[model samples]
Target chain A: MKFLCTRCDEVMKLAGAQAGDDTVGLTFSCPKCGGSFAMLTNPAETTLVKGLGVQVGGRSEPAPLMEVIQSSVARDTENQITWDPGAETRLANVPPFARPMARKAIERFAESKGIRTITAAVMDEARALM
Target chain B: MRMYHEVAGDGGSDILGQVGKMMERLAGRLSLIKSVIAVASPKGGVGKSTVAAHLAASLARRGARVGALDADLYGSSLPRLLAPEFIGANATRGEEGLFPIAGVFGVRVMSLDYLTGYGARASVAWAGAGGSITRGPVEASALRELLADTQWGELDYLIVDTPPSVGRLGDLTALVPSLAGVVLVSAPTLLAYQVTLKSIERVRALGVPLLGLVENMRGFTCDLCGAANRINVEGEMGETLSIMGVPALGALPYDQRLLKPAGEAGPIEAVERIADALLAKIGGHAAARA
Candidate 1:
């Protein structure tokens, strides 16, 4: 199987069949960028896929959705507030390329603080941290 | 739904997808060599390239299929150093990749000099229009791709001649994470030793095994009387090596015979000794597998 580094764009070839099982995870270091990433056996023969097992920097944390649900529901039982108009406006200011990561970070922050309704102030604090 | 739902719900962005594709490409490139050795120094003009060429030649002479990769992009010297004796017949191209030009003693060679047609005059005039290659993300990417794209056939060893800098050392380590070892070259001068120590620290920080330090130009041999006089600050260099906790592989005296196109055999013997020490330090393919 082949893997390309996100940072340096250099291709690495690994013996995918060596992994054996379909669910096998292979950890490799990019010779070019020195970045470490994991790949799992792809269902299609001779292919591989990412995201099923990728843990950069060796840090493992709670799932993003789990963090949000626990933080938001723990404090306010009935707080189901959606994005405030002001918050949406601020989110629009985020670049399209980074919008997804920025938005997820903001949601996690709001859920942690028991803020079900995201306001401009929440976006302000999220923007600050990022 | 989460706040990021809309953004992520539209699948991932094109940029993220592109990054994923690139990462996959990096993972699939494989090396054919059994052991990869990098020869580096933090400062330039310490005979790092000379040491690399000789090491490659020494290994090849031993019937080991060795390949010398001149990683010094801007100021390449391998082609010039070995060109007289090791002629580049021609670089064959195919669907796989360009074949490395064969050098002296049947050692396969690859360098930017061959690509730019610069040969040994890379340091003097890399480009005709005063063009200079700047260091940055783009250049770094290009270097990485160049290394990955090379089609090196099966070999016993691949000696990489790295540029003088900590960054290039890091990049090489990243490119070949399973490096057999790093052989540092330095002259017996205060400045060169100081920078070499920094390189030692950088290599250690990267967790790459350092084979040992080679004190190049440790002394001068007089051709008239055939007397070898050790240069000054030898004791200080020993202290630096002690502080760094790396063994001194060998000390190569300054031999004027190396300046010629066809290098003399005497000085090259010193390089072979260092290569022997490095192989001993590697402890066979067991350490290489580790």
Candidate 2:
């Protein structure tokens, strides 16, 4: 089967597939743009390539790509949150991995007080609440 | 007929090997959005899209930046609900990324209707005829990219309107693990309520917060006699959801005025009422965040 690059319209063929196998790895550099794209195939292969072309920096080491990806996923399990400048500085006391959770806690604290902005005082209150 | 050739060995030979990396990349791209909320149902015709569109509009109205992401790949209705002009065209692209089309009240929107090249109107026709652009795991991954690739700017809220399908819900949860919450939309009918309960269970199993349940089209009002009566559906929906620990957001009565053309003004009053209650909870949660 063939898959099209959603960005450059470059077509890449799938490596031979075994019968009844629903999944397959498809990778190709779109000659048109010299950008790399990869995917595990499914019936809707076209949509999977949502205009993303991984810009390959100079290839030196075969990255433990999967490992890097796994670590990122594990980290993302914690919510990424926003913070006001004062509140963010206050979060310096919190651990890096725990900052996201702390941010959420602070926002909730602010919301309770009908506070839209998270100042240092709000952060102090949030820390107590948490 | 081949415009391009396949590389013999590049990247990973095992196609399934890239799923994790793909998901990781996607999550990284979408990290900027503050809150991700999905409006879902277990069955169709439950007014899920209407809820999502109006909720987003309401959020935008409250002086917060907002975006509406239509995740219904097969039957996208956000374009029509929010920005009808974008119905047959693709969202414009820029050097930064694909710009989400600004719709009514400045709400950014991204949908398959704006992404597919197959004339958005034509695609809807095909979807209505029981055709889909893709299926299975690929569909899930595609949705991840859709959300990741759109340049939503700094949004305070992103309302994801999803189709009523088990697989579609899986796709959303897989892509958005940090989702703030999910609002299950259902009619006041027993059948709709039961189906919504199953959806609530699935969302809970995934660990995404359940914001609440919204009873859409709750009761019909008589125009002539000004009489209000609950729809023939029988069930204590609020009590049912409350038993499961999910708050009832409030019911939106059916209104015939919604069927009339509103044009550029966005969704009807019914949807807006639900949106108002939802926003209050969101606001209250921040104040009462545990």
- In candidate 1, position A51 carries an lDDT of 22
- Which 10 successive residues of model 1 chain B have the least lDDT summed? B125-134
Native-referenced DockQ of model 2: 0.03
Which parts of model 2 are misplaced by more than 4 Å? A1-130, B1-25, B124-134, B260-273, B284-290
Worst 10 residues of 2 chain B by lDDT: B124-133
- Model 1 residue B15 lDDT score: 37
Per-residue error (Å), model 1, residue B36: 1.2
Fnat of each prediction, in sequence: 0.00, 0.02
Q: Candidate 1 - CAPRI tier?
A: incorrect
> Using TM-score as the measure, which candidate wins?
2
lDDT of 1 by residue, B1-290 (tens): 22333223222123344445444443444456678888988888888888888878777778899888878876776766655532322233334454566566767777754443222332322111112222233334444544555566678888888888856787777667778888888888888877777667778888888888988888887889988888855447776587768988897887765564323364466777887998898775345567
Q: Model 2 clash pairs?
A: A24-B15, A25-B15, A44-B134, A108-B286, A111-B287, A112-B287
lDDT of 2 by residue, B144-197 (tens): 656766777788899999888544677688678777778988888788877888
What's the TM-score of candidate 2 when only chain A is evaluated? 0.34
Tell me how large the interface RMSD of candidate 1 is.
27.0
Return the TM-score for each candidate structure: 0.60, 0.62
